[model samples]
Target: MIGSVANMLAHVKNCSKARKVLIYIPYSKFKFNLLLAFERYGFVKRVSLLRYSTNRSEILIELAYNGYYNMIQDIVQVSKPGQRIYWKKKQLRVKHQIGTYFLSTSNGIKTNLDSTCVGGEVICNLV
Candidate 1:
C-alpha cells in the first residue's frame, strides 16, 4: 500500500498539465509542515490557508499554478483530519445541493477539486 501510494505521488509530481492545486488540512501542525514542504520545494506560487472549524480543526489551501507542472504528482501522505479536503484538478462542472459558496477567479475558470466527505457541496474555480 505504501509503495502504491508513493507511485501515485510520483505520478502527480511528474504531471505537466495541472496548473493549480488546493489542499485542506485540519491541523495547524500538519498545515505548517505542508507549508514548509511547499516552501522547501518551491512547488506552488500562491498558497492560501483558511481555518475551518475550531472544534473540528480544519484548513484549506489554495495554490496558484505559475508554470511548474513537474510537481503535480507528488503525493502527500497523512491521515485526514477531522475535517479535511483534497482537490486534484481545475477543469470540471461543479454542483452543490446544500447551501455553499462558490469561489472562482475573476475570469471565472473552473478549478479542479477532489473532495472526500460524508456530505457537502463541492466548489471550484479554474482561473
Candidate 2:
C-alpha cells in the first residue's frame, strides 16, 4: 500500500527530522533516481540497494548532516494523484539554488542541476 511517491517523500522527511542514520524504503526506479539526484547535490551520504525478505528489494538511504543540522530543512510533495502540477520549459524556475526538485520528466527523472528543460509532474521539492 505504501507505493506512492508522496508516501516515500513523507517517510524521508520524517527520517530527516529524526536524524536517522539509515532508512529502508521499498524499491522503485523513480525513487532510486530521486535518491541519486539528492546524492548528486550532497544532500545524502549514501544510497544502496539490498535484498529484503529474501525475495523483494529495498533501498537503504543514509541521511546527511553537518554538525547537528540535517541537510534537508523540508521536503514537500508537489504532485499527487489528487492534484498534479506541471511546469513548461519556459515556466521552469528554481526558487532556491540549494533546493532540489524531483521532476518526472518525459525523458526520465531529472534534478534541478540538469538544464535540458523538461515538462512533467513535479514530484517533490527537497531542501
Candidate 3:
C-alpha cells in the first residue's frame, strides 16, 4: 500500500500525457475521494465506479483536456506512506494561479480553495 496513492496519481498523469480519454484504476475509498477532489477542482472531467468480473471494482476517470494540453499539468505527492505531512488551514497556501493543494481533512478530501476546509494531511499539489 505504500505506493498505492502515488500509483493513482501516476495513472492519471500518464493517461493524460498519452492523450487518452479515459483510464481505469483499482478502486478504494481513499482513491475515490481523491478523484472527487480532482473533479471538484476541474482537473478531471468525470469520475465513476465500475464493477465487473467477480465483484472487482475499478475507477473510471475521464481526463479533461484543453486542445493539446491536459487540465492537470502535474501532480506532486507531498505526503508519502513513510512520511506524512500535515498542515493547518492557516498554513495552507497555493503559490501558483493554476495550482491546487489537496488535503485530507477531517471532513473529507478537499482542495485548498474549499472555504470550509479544516486541513489534515497534505495529500498532493495539483497543477
Candidate 4:
C-alpha cells in the first residue's frame, strides 16, 4: 500500500512530466487539504472528489502549465517518515523561492505566505 505523502507526491510529479491534463490520486484528508491550498496558489486548475468506498475516496487534480511547460518545476518533501521537520511562523518569514512552502498549521494546510498562526510540520516545498 503506497500511502506515504512522499509517494503520493512523486506520482504527481510524474503526471506533470507526462503532461497530463488531469490525474486521480488516493485521497487523504491531509493531501486533499494540501491540494486545495495548491489550487489557491494557481498550481492546479480544478479539483473534484470521487467517492469510491465508504472510507476511501479519490481526487481528480487538473494540472496547470505555462505554454506547455509544467508549472511545477520541482516538489520536494521536507519532513519524512524517518526525520521530521517542524517550522514556526518566524522561521517561515523568509521569502520562499519560485515555489512555496506547504505547512501544517493550527488552522490547516497553508502556504508560508498565508500562514499566520504558529506553523507546524513542514510538509513539502512546491516549485
Candidate 5:
C-alpha cells in the first residue's frame, strides 16, 4: 500500500519545481479530493481523470504557473504513515497567515478554515 496523499503532494511539488505543465499520478478518492482542494486555492489549473482501468488508474493534473514563477511555492505533508497528526477543534486555528491547510474531517476533506468546529487528521499544507 502507498501513502497516496503524501505521494500525490510530492509529485505535485516536484512537477511544479521542474516547471512541468502536466503530471500524472495514481488515482484515489482522497488524492482526487485533495487535488480539488488545491484547485480551490488556484495552485492547480485543472484536475481531470486521465486514464481508467481496473488494475491502475491515473489523474491528470495541470500545474498552475505565473510566467516564470510557480503558483505553488511548497507543499508540506503534516501527517505521515508513521507519525499521524491530529488536532482538536480548538486547536484548528489559522496558524499561518499565508498558507492553507487541508484536513480529513468528519465533514470530509476540508481546509482548516472551513471545518473548524470539527477536528481531523492534518493532511497537508500549501505554502
Candidate 6:
C-alpha cells in the first residue's frame, strides 16, 4: 500500500511545474516515508518540519518547490484524511486555510487567532 501511494506521488512530482513544493504530513511516520520517497527521486530541494505538538501525533512538512506548486497541491488535496482522532470532547470549529498544516488530537482543536497569525495554530494537547 505504501509503495503504491509513493508511486502515485512520484507521478505527481514528475508532472509538477512549480518553483517550490509544500508537503504536509499530519503523521510523523508517513512524513518520514514521504521525505524518503522525495529524496530517492531527487525531486525535493529542501524539507522542513514546521509544526509539532505532543497532543497530536502528527507532523507538518514544508517542501521548497522549483516549479511544481500546482501539481503538489493536486496531490495533497487527494491524500487521505490525516486526522488522528475521530471525535473530540470539546469540539471547536476553527477556520483553516486550504493548505495550512494541522493535526487533530483527542482533546480537540485549540487555537489563538487574536494574535499575530490568523487561526494562529491548533494545538491538540489532550491525549
Which prediction has the highest lDDT against the true structure? 3
* Residue-level error in angstroms, candidate 1, position 111: 30
Tens-digit lDDT track of model 4 for 9-85: 89889989889898998887778888888888988888778998899889999999989788887889888877888
**Top-TM-score structure, candidate number:** 3
Inter-residue clash pairs, candidate 5: none
What is the model-wide C-alpha lDDT for candidate 6?
A: 0.38
Candidates sorted on lDDT, descending: 3, 4, 5, 2, 6, 1
lDDT of 3 by residue, 18-125 (tens): 889989999988999889878887899999999887569999999998888889888888899889998887876545445788888888888788888887888888
What is the overall TM-score of model 4 with all chains considered together?
Answer: 0.89
The residue-level lDDT of candidate 3 at 21 comes to 94
The runs of at least 3 residues in candidate 2 whose Cα sits more than 4 Å from the true structure, single-residue gaps closed, are 1-3, 52-54, 94-98
CA RMSD of all predictions: 16.2, 2.5, 1.9, 2.1, 2.0, 15.4
Candidate 3 TM-score to native: 0.90
CA lDDT of each prediction against the hidden true structure: 0.36, 0.79, 0.85, 0.83, 0.82, 0.38
- Residue 21 in candidate 4, Cα distance off native in Å: 1.3
lDDT of each residue in 9-105, candidate 6, tens digit only = 5544544544334544445544455454444434444445544566554333344454533324344422243632332322334454343232322
| Candidate order by decreasing TM-score | 3, 4, 5, 2, 1, 6
| Candidate 2 global Cα RMSD | 2.5
* Candidate 3: stretches off by over 4 Å: 94-98
**Residues 1-127, candidate 2, lDDT per residue (tens digit)?**
2136677788889989988989999887778888887888888899988886777999999999999999988998777776788877655664644567777887877765578856677777787
**RMSD to the native, candidate 5?**
2.0
Worst 10 residues of 6 by lDDT: 118-127
Give the residue spans of candidate 4 off by over 4 A: 1-3, 95-98, 115-117
